[model samples]
Target chain A: MNLPCIVTALPAESRPFFEHFKLQGRELNGLQLYSCERCLLLQTGVGKLAAASKMAALLQECPDITGVVNIGIAGADAPIGTQLVAGCVEDAGSGKRWFPHLPPLRALPDLKSVVVQTHDKPETQYKNGIAFDMEAAGIFSAARGKLDSSSVQCIKVVSDNHSSLVSAIDKSQVFNWMASCIPVVDIMIDLMADPIRDQVRQVDEFTESAAQKVHFTVTQLHQLHRMTTQHLTLCSSLPTLYGSDAKSILQRLKDELAATPLSYTNPMVKDA
Target chain B: MDTIYIEEQISEHPRTLAILKRYPKARLVSIDRYNEVFNNASQNFRKQKQNPALILAKKEGERVLPTPDQYHIGGQHNYYFSHMLNCIYDCRYCFLQGMYRSANYVVFVNYEDFFADIETITAQHKKPSWYFSGYDCDSLALEPITQFVEQCLDAFSEIPQAWLELRTKSTQIRPLLNREAIDNCVVAFSLSPEEIVQAEEHKTASLEKRINALQQLQAHGWKIGLRFDPLIQASEFERLYGRMFEQVLSAIDIEAVHSVSLGPFRLPRDFHKKMIKLYPDSKLLSAQLEYNGTHVSYPESTEKAMIDWCEATLLSRISSEQYFPCVSS
Candidate 1:
């Protein structure tokens, strides 16, 4: 699977991810890009618009990066340094909400699940029991537009709550809170990335080699691919291509497959 | 459902309140409308299916819709209504996975509106009409939670001219058994061979359980239906389905059966495409199927042969008058 790209709002929030993932700093398409073998971290300047723009551009440049993890610091009613995984992200201005596909609780047992209300500026005087952030909705909207909802996730560490004020928060404290969340953050990244890996279809080397031997149109290739998938699935192997011509071979394959009784064994069933 | 999304309009609705009381520990989120979450663009159906939340909203607009020409039992005028959007069971071949982008269940709590619409439609027809439930979801799957069937039975009792078909693969029949069997309601159960049930229909009642439920309902004097719709193909399908038919027919007094329907496994072109994407490794979706313009199904001759075999087998057990083969429009 392609490495999950981690999008953070500010450099302070990105620092823990950078050090943890050992991401090397580089400039990509005029945006601050950090990367390593495990993940890619993009530091979008604070706020929703910047996160959306930078994240969209990064995903556009790297189309293979299907999974996106938006991690940042947030103000909530919880104690400081508490990590949260967002069940829903709502734009306070537009009343728009995005529920990122939440994995099973057991997969994220350590982090509390909360609704994240995203605003234009940092939120203070937290109420309503929901976490407040500036960029979760933006990152989610952009990533979901590019990838599936299952591939997009946002996690935040509580930097300020009603007891503590936003202005009282410092970069060193933010870094410390994020550093504490690295274990759970790693789990979330793997949880998002694993599905993409499982979704990848096994490469059909035989089909590729067969296409090389015989020229096929674009439409023919699609048909051939589906036909080959069915043939392999039912018969467990493809019939030999005896004839030199593509039409004759295709016809022979189709004829043989039709006569084969449509039988299937469910993979989930044991002793099938 | 761990989290319940309640619309502000129906937050205080009696049904909504009852549901809230049932799931007391559920996280409640207030929404202006259901589509704000349900009809959103970026929702993923497969992932949501794993841990789906319930969206309790008042269904607005045209709640009653005319059934497709091919969908009916005996009545000339047929319609279908959905009190719930998604089913609890996940059959690999179900079209709901293709039709809706979200797997979250949306239960329209306004049962009075649906019954009112049904009443209006029946009155407009001025004749016996059929209103089929379970088109978009299994009729009795979440019976205890929704209590939809109890209210539906009461609604149908008031309108004797209208026929209510509660098609399901669920074994939740206690609610029906607790009340007197209404003549206008037919408690239909969707049956398949045990092999198919085990393989494809995930989280549904076993064939034995469904038969047991139907038999109890039949004994209670409720009209029961046998739905052999979406007939799947197998190498030894004749033997498998034949044995199943024997088992099912022998269990119930065939004379008590209200109707039996047969349909081939088929889906609209777009729905088939979407389903294939959701379950690429599914052998059922990967079968060497034929596409006839707008829908996909078994090869013409193969489908005809299977139907012929099933028809012949069923004919031996029941008369032709009770059979209904669903034909495509």
Candidate 2:
């Protein structure tokens, strides 16, 4: 099963996610890796270079990792507690930019997303229109090549806006912000991981014996999976039918479904 | 309206300036070229959909091309031009979701250039050529913002021999209603059973609203067409489509209707894979499908059943001359 990787710049920023998932923490290559069955939360110390190096290592170690979500406390120009999704992450020093891809329904729908600038240091004065963080560009740039843009999300809740620079911000308050965001983070994890879990469940339900007998190619396997999932959801659970191979089974299923009477999945259809 | 990314070349374009003025609140960022952002790797189709950005750029190369002959509706020398890429509606069956990496809407503001290309193509044919406006995007869904159809109507008017088809599932026909209906243009509306529309065709005008719009357009002397194209598969579809036809035929004068086209739901294998990945849980995508060569669709028997039933139901009402069942799509 492919699991989502969660990366945070600081251990403090990673605490709430760790506490929420109740992950057993371990250290690999001098970086902390906290994980559960569905996800792994990796904490990179500080700054862009650290974020990039640690993220690169984490993905290298977990080659099957599906996607990554980079979460941390960020200083934005908005209210102190405003939650923001990063639409674009710009590295200020080199003027490089990465538009972090977010999945449609998988993201927290109502949060405001904005452009974020990753700086060498915290900005106390330049705070009228965007978000300033130290790690998103690094994490995104590193994870981007290994994943699709939509699968990598860089999101944050405000710890300090224009009120204070990184130096004057309270650590405990950042902890509270991180702690409160646990529920939202959990929701994201569920949205991202549910498809993976469902796919596994489907494979389990499909029966390995029949699969081995059929010797279906990759495309045929996916086609069967798609048909089975739809049938289970809209019509009925797939039944064991007599067939010599995968092709026969698919054809038999088609015959069965075609013979079945019309049943609409959407309730509005019943009304119509 | 989400954030909009601008290409550096088109930042100073007059049309781009007008669009930016409309969405004053949207964050505008500049990229070196349109593809730099639109073609970015690992972009999630579903996530970007929630807050899709608007990418404004200048379209280059082959502005107009021949439509796959299978998509014809009694037009000679059929060609389609897209002022935009991707669409506003999130229809589950649309091929656009799989065709592009990003769900964001990209509008090429160079209207004059597209018309100029059409002008060149029109001169090549002795018979009137057909220009389809909604191949890549809805014809009128963004009419209020782009006002492209309004401009297209004017451009088509100059070449009276050229026919324009603004195919859409949009109820935004005020621009057409406000002006006199042009004889050369056919405003085609896509139709399906309300059950399928509700289940899969998200953010489109309802069946009732579309019929109402068609009735209004007919009243204004516009020639409309019924696009039962991409006919979706479901249980008891005949009963559903039967009732739909009764409602639709009863609503308008079939004689005034320009034509009717019926094509089964089909997509290239690669597009289907992309769509399945984007919408893992979509029941419509999961329906019993047959992989035929490079494309996938309902099994031949099932496809025949759908088209045969619809044809029997429809041809019984309208003449066979005006009805075209697309053999393959």
Most accurate candidate by lDDT: 1
lDDT of 2 by residue, B31-135 (tens): 778887888766777767766888999989999999987767787799999999988889999998898888888999989999999999999999999988889
- List, residue by residue over A105-197, the lDDT tens digit for candidate 1: 666766767889999988786875599999988887778887876778888888888788888989999888878878877876776654424
Cα lDDT tens digits for candidate 1, B1-329: 66688899999999999999997656566778998778877767877887788999999999989999988888899999999999999899898988898898999999999999999889987779999999999999999999999999999999999999999999889999899999999888999988899888999998889999989999899999999988999987887788889989999999879999899999899999888777766778877688899999998988999999999999988988889998685
Quote the positional error of residue A261 for candidate 1 in Å.
Answer: 3.2
TM-score of each: 0.92, 0.83
Stretches > 4 Å off in candidate 1: A19-32, A35-38, A93-95, A109-114, A193-199, A204-213, A235-249, A264-272
- On DockQ, the candidate that comes out on top is 1
- The superposed Cα distance between candidate 2 and the true structure at residue B252, in angstroms, equals 0.8
